[model samples]
Target: MKFLIAFLAVVAVALAGPIDERGAQIVKYTNDHQGISGYNVEVETSNGIRTIEQAELRNLGNDNAAIVVRGSYSYTGDDGQVYTVNYIADENGFQPEAAHLPRA
Candidate 1:
């Protein structure tokens, strides 16, 4: 019984470390977009297709996500369209539209 408990404790610590690391990654991504206000891109992955919206992005500083500027992107061409966009992060930052971002 003692051995089982010790093994469980070790397993819990191992699992906890990864969770903290993932949480830190999320914070890094969120902080990377801080104070951004105006026309910005949003990236998301879905079951059917990936999505990128050219909406006004605002850094609300909340964990959920950076705020999307309300009602400002209704007429934008890429406003509501869904696409197979892949959001790749590099040394520069989050590249929602890989094609549009200039190659370094």
Candidate 2:
């Protein structure tokens, strides 16, 4: 039991990874009111991170009404490569697409 516990402890520490000491600052940001129905947002960070999203009300004032969201985000990975993901969430479900993702 002790050996198992110590093994698990070691695995946890290895998986946790080292904390980054650097700080990221927001370099750009924008929020726009697209009327009473929805809004749009965009942001960029000094540390090579960016995201944009838009939301709109669907089926307004109905029992099945929902807010549909569409968005994309990009960030620099540890390997120094930029990764971007585009996504949408609506009546069906959340779908994300990116070059790195495997084909279904």
Candidate 3:
């Protein structure tokens, strides 16, 4: 009875942690192939703030991967523009497009 209780406790503890399969794959690819696989950031300043809500890495096979980031930013200024951007990074480099990117 005591052994059974201890085993159940250990199993419950193990199940309490979140599992991230995609993140594990990204780490594996990064370490094995020296590839850029993921990104996450959030920053705030007096004038502006930005947050990266989701960033993921997709394996394209052949040791290649693609990084996709979804984020939003706001500026506390006269324009007071707020918008979201989706970015992709791969062999071609980073490509980011924003629906409300400020134009000069």
Once superposed on the true structure, which residue ranges of model 3 sit more than 4 Å away at CA?
1-37, 60-64, 80-104
Q: Relative to the unseen true structure, what is the C-alpha lDDT of residue 63 in candidate 1, on a scale of 0 to 100?
A: 52
The lDDT values for all models are: 0.39, 0.91, 0.54
TM-score of 2: 0.73
TM-scores, all candidates, are 0.24, 0.73, 0.37
Over 38-78, each residue of candidate 3 has an lDDT whose tens digit, in order, gives 55565554324444444667775557766655555443434
lDDT of 3: 0.54
Worst 10-residue lDDT window, candidate 3:
24-33
Arranged by lDDT with the best first, the candidates are 2, 3, 1
Candidate that would win on lDDT: 2
- Counting clashing residue pairs in each candidate, in order, gives 0, 0, 0
lDDT of 2 by residue, 1-104 (tens): 99999999999998777536377789999999888698899999887889999999999988999889999999888776899999999998999999999979
